[model samples]
Target chain A: MIEFIPSAFAATFSVSVLLALAAGTFAGIIIGALPGLGTVLGLVMALPFTYVMDPATAIALLLSIYVSSIYGGSISAILINVPGTPQSAASVFDGYPMAQRGDGALALGYATVGSFIGGIFSLIVLVLIAPQLAKFALQFGPIETFALIVFALTTIAWVSSGEMLKGLLSATIGLFLALIGPDAMTGQIRFNFDSLFLSAGLTVIPLLIGFFAVSEILYQAAVLKDVKLPAVTSGGFKLAPWSEWKPRIMVILRSCGIGSFIGVLPGTGATAAVFVSYADAKRRSPNPEDFGKGEPSGLLASEASNNAVSGGAMVPMMALGIPGDGGTVVLMGALTIHNVIPGVRLFSQQPDLVTLIFVLLFLSNILMLFIGGFGANLFSRMLRIPTTLLMPLVFMMSVVGAYAIRSNPVDLFVVVIFGVVGFLLRLNRFPPAPIIIGFVLGAPLEMSLRQGLILTDMNFLAFFASPIALILFCITGLIILNLFGLGNAISKRFRRKETQSNN
Target chain B: MQQKNADMLYGAVLAGMACAMFAHTFSPIYQNEFLFGDVSTVFFPRVLLGIIFVLSMMLVVKGKLSTSDAILTQINVKRVLLTGGATLITVVGVWYLGYLVMMPVGVFLIGLALGYPNLVILGITSLISPLVVWVILAKFAQVSFAPGTLL
Candidate 1:
């Protein structure tokens, strides 16, 4: 992998790849700055273009968008009092306050600089941790793999939605959707309703387009009121003086660490990281009372932590073939289209490509820093584009994206159907990310389970024989128990007994 | 509607679908014949449907036991339905009339349905954006757009 760095650089510096990096970064900033469109939708819209690009260019494009979009969210958070993406939700606590105080440029500066540092910090963590994680995963047999997938899916569901039951239901629905096409083991189709198109199974791209993009369109239509656009605070590049930043350096670094750590945990994403980091920053600050009231540290903590999650989230996706969030799930889907299967073997089989991904990510963060700074005003202006006007373009893009993948007309229907279903499910408060995660992981989960069962002579008990699998199963059981509040009950009982014994 | 009722309704509907899917797993379409202890193709799907059914029931029970006074988001039903209808028509239109033809109409109709107040902007964007996209994707990237049979 170390030796492959030179080639990775050579590959990345190509005209096409560089162009993709610049374009993707620019488009990502605009998309992220917009209120409705976020990282997942940005990736979905970029998917069709990737179909025509080579593997290197495609990876560059997607990686740039993924990194920059997370950073882009802070622009809106600063100017419009609305976080462009959920990951930036915490930014509004301080970002908007700063803008209201006529310090929008300085707030954007903190966000941009903090995001850059966070990104680079996470990239370092990714480079160090991913290959090692991949190496450890390579030792996992079918049973361990099965256990890991279950744990990942369970954790994702638990964290993704407010209602754990709804999240679980959404995940189950996604798993079922994955089973609709041909069975991987037997090549026999199931639940396709005898349609010629049903046998082939649902493609991730169309499903993604439907669920994220199209569903968003519908969801917007349902909720969007005919109102004037909110006034946007002025935005420009203004670096906070060194004196202003000196005291807040620790906060930025700590938030980045928190974000990177949380990102490494499957299913816990930037949204969780930002809030946690913000709380930590406030708690640790000497002037905690100043926090969240136009405090630069709070804005930095939110922006940095969320941006750091970008690199952190990719670790699981690139190493273990597990997506940590919706953005990574979409990124995983894009990688698959280019025949770049991300898993344990990815490290050994294509170290060069892995190196290339790392390099692309690094470059994307750098580009995000420059592009975000120079283009702040442009993105701020973009926030004025009404959802009414933009969503229609998004719909058109969704149409093109769905149809362009394999040029199958049936995919158009899949996008529409999933879009409506996604919108309806969202209205009912079911988290869409878990569904996409479950769908992406579904086939592999089933395959690993069946293989493990076969290896164990069809004895389900034997699945726990492996120490790794046993630990994973135990952790999963604990998570499920916690979800049901049984873990708390049991803990309370133990505490009561301990108190009695102490008395 | 109350959040509880919405949950209950959604849960019941999902449970019904799960049950139907579970029954389909037992259909003759699934070759029940086991080969060297390999499970049938229906095995995994059955397991999934079973999980779905259980979860759906849990949702219904949770809904029943709920005390929260939360209400579901108020949807603009007419706008949603009209937008959905427009989307369907646009997709179907693309299939019949081709990308170049239906895409602009689709974009325009979707914009109209979404209540974009500025008709001129909507019309220009609907017409020009598709052509720009077509030129880039079809000409530069070599993507093959849908050429309608009618055209």
Candidate 2:
């Protein structure tokens, strides 16, 4: 890892890193301020623009947005009960309560600081760990890479909202949906008909936007037309003093460290990290009673860890070609479209650009302090923005973002279909992220595993032979047990109370 | 829907998916190519189909909807429209307007849907977001995209 200073590289950003970060941070905040507009959706929306820019700038912008959006989400969660992004779900545990008690300013202040701390920690991790991971990744082959992907996918069930069966079912749905286009192995196409677009397979970005963004909007519009915005005292300023923050520093760091580590795991995103950290903090605290009753530490822990996930997710993506989440999936796709290949070689091949990106992520997270600092106040003001003016604009951006992915109307239709599927599933308690997991992994999982299977002469059960595979299997098994009612006893044994609200 | 009916519907979806697999499996195109003593590429999907079929059956009998109706009620229509509209926008935007214009437009629309109205805020959001995308995707990453006719 290079002991690089982001400030030293600011002058070099004329190559587009500065512009990317500026633009990315701006969009990230807006997306985060709005409830349910996720970073994946935001990045997918931005995919088209990358076609015209430099890869470093493109990555910087994307990374910056990814980082800032994670933090921006707390604005809504803290000021209003609704989490702007799912990762901020834990933020509401205390964030909203604080607001309810007319401490909205205090909550935002603590959350902003916590998020800044978390983001910085994760970026530092990216600097320290990413290169090491890249070094280790060089030792991997198709077998190791495949094992890693499997491990990531298995985490879906573990990190899923509730019910491993549903999570597994959700993963199954994603895997199948992925099969709808081409046969990756042969030159032949499998699911496509005469439609010209079918030969290329469904674009993942449009699918993500539809399922996560458009579908979410449709569901919200259909039901929450008159969402009750919580009472607010215009929370745009910092309410907590330095002294109040001093005590929570350790808690924030611990949360960020935990969050960053989990974020690197893929599937286990910031939301899960936040909830887990909050629970851990609460359990370890002498003042456990302070938690869930508008305690600053709980919110601090939640924000710190979730923000940290931004950096953590990048480790695997940079080291291996495996993108850790939907956001990185889009980033990889965008880069591929730009001809920027990832893997162990990317660092050595494009050290300047890659290093530039590392520094940009660092700068973006640190800059987030300023962006998030003032952004918190401005976002709090957004609660008063009339939806009459609000929703149409959101619809507009999603529509535009969808179009950029492939410039295909068919993709738009897919988005709508996925949106409907997402809505129905949400009603049925089906999480949309799994659909993405399915789509993202769909072709790769089938094609790769099939190749591995064929190479092993249909041993079929070769999946279980490897040590890594066994560990992944265990994780999947644990997730299944946890996601289902099967692990309730074990979980109860592990903890005294189940006060950790499921996000 | 009642638990019984929901379970039935889920089972049907799984069953249909399984049938789709069987069609692919038994078809001459696949079965005729019996590579490696009748074990070939179709095995993976076939295995998947079998697993899905089993899972579906389990749902038909032992499966529970898990979520209470009250929770379902909260997921409502606006969320659906928002997600649907965003998808429609992204898919259609790329097809019609240039990618340059479409990126900002998508951001604005998503921002709008989530309840941000001030044109200035929306404009800043729309413009800035695309530029970032353009720089990363176009400039740094070295990938190409669908630039609209206007550009």
Candidate 3:
């Protein structure tokens, strides 16, 4: 696989791939800087173009957009207090303050450098860990796989929505949606209401466009009160002296580690990582009072950790075929369109493609650093583009994207239907990501469970006999116990009993 | 509406839907041939529907006992309906009128519905953006677009 690096580089340096990298980076930055069009929507809009692209070029484009879009969010965060993406929500704490004080260029410098380091750190983690994880996954039989999917879904649901019950309900709904098409093992169509279109099953792309893009448009329409653009802070790029950055080196490294670790976990995404890293950075800072007042360390921790998540989130998606967040879900969907199925088999079967992905991610980060620095002012200017104007364009792209895939007019309706469904669900405080995760993992979960059951000759309890499956199920049980507050209650009772005994 | 009331209502609706779906799983369309002994085609879906039913019931219980005073966000129902209606019309328009002919109109209509202030800019962008996109996607990328039957 190491030998494939040279070939990967040769492939990446091709005119077509390089063009894709540049265009993806440029478009991603603008999309990110503009509030309301974040990484998922950026990828959704880019999906139609990928229909004609070769796999390599398509992956290059998506990878660049994914990496750069995360970085692009800081532009809006710094220039205006509005975060362009949810992942960058923490960036505004210190970034906007710095810009308010006319150090916007220096702030941009810190964010760009921190994002680069974080990206590189995560890429290294990805390169080292993904293959090893994939190798470990090869040992999993159907029982273990079922256990793993259940655990992953549980963890995802627990963290996605604030309310555990709502999250679980959302996930269950998603699972039901996946079951609507047909049963894979028995060739029996279960929930299709006798329509011809119902038998073929739903495709991920249209579902994605509906849930992430069209639903967003409807949500925005419902909530948007002000069409006026926020005032932009001055933006430029100026690298801070080494003396200024030297003290923050530890903060950057700590944030990179935090982001990478959190990113590797299923369902917890960069948003979680950034806030956690920010709090940790503040806790350890000597000048904690200055933390939110244009503190470079705070900015560094927020920016670095969020960007680092770009690499960390891919680990589960690439290694286990489990998406960590909406961005990766869209990425996974795109990869499937190109017939590049991600999972335990992907590492062994297509080492070359994996190597190319690594190279592409590495190049994307590098491109982000250069492009982010040079294009800071331009991105700040783009913040003036109102959501009112941008959303119509998104809607158009949604229509085109849905129709372009398989050329089915029914898919257009799928986009509209899911769009409304997604919007309604969101209005009711149901988190959308778990639904997608549930949908994606639904088929595999059913297959693995049935297969495991067959292997055990209908002895359901035999699933627990596998040590790996047992451990996974135990963890899931603990999570469920915690969700119900039983874990905490039991621990508190035990502690009280211990105190009484000591007395 | 209060958050609790909304949740209870949503849960009841979902529970009802789940019950309907669960019953439908036993319909003859499923072909209930059990090649794997106990596992039939409807087996997994039944399990899922059952989970949904239980979860929704729990949601209703939780909502009934909830003490929080949080209210649901004030939604502009008229705007949501208008925007959704505009989107559906756009899709239907594209179906009959073709991508090249109806897309610009769709974009313009959506923009107007979303309350874009600058009509001139909206008109220009709505007209030109789709044309540019079509040119690039259709001509350069060799992707096909629906030509309107009416056109």
Candidate 2, residue A379: the lDDT equals 67
Per-residue lDDT for A1-503 in model 3, tens only?
89999999999989999999999999998998899999999999999999999999999999999999998999899989999999899999999999999999999999899999999999999999999999999999999999999998888888885677788888888877787776788766657787889888888889889999999999999899878878999999999999999999999999999999999999899999999999999999999999889999999999999999999999999999999789999999999999999999999999999999999999999999999989887888889999989998999889888988988888999999999999988998888888887888889999998998889998889999999999999999988888778988999999999999999
> For residues A148-263, could you state the per-residue lDDT of candidate 2 as single tens digits?
66666667644667545566677777777676656666545545545677767777677776777656566666665554454545577575878887887789888988999998
Candidate 1 regions exceeding 4 Å error are A491-503
Give DockQ per model, in order. Answer: 0.81, 0.29, 0.76
Off by over 4 Å in 2: A1-12, A96-106, A225-231, A239-241, A292-294, A341-353, A386-389, A461-465, A474-503, B31-39, B64-71, B74-151
On TM-score, the stronger of 1 and 2 is: 1
Candidate number that wins on lDDT, 2 or 3: 3
lDDT of 3 at A250: 97
What residue pairs clash in candidate 3, if any at all?
B97-B148
* Residue A255 shift from truth in candidate 3, angstroms: 0.1
State the TM-score for model 3.
0.98
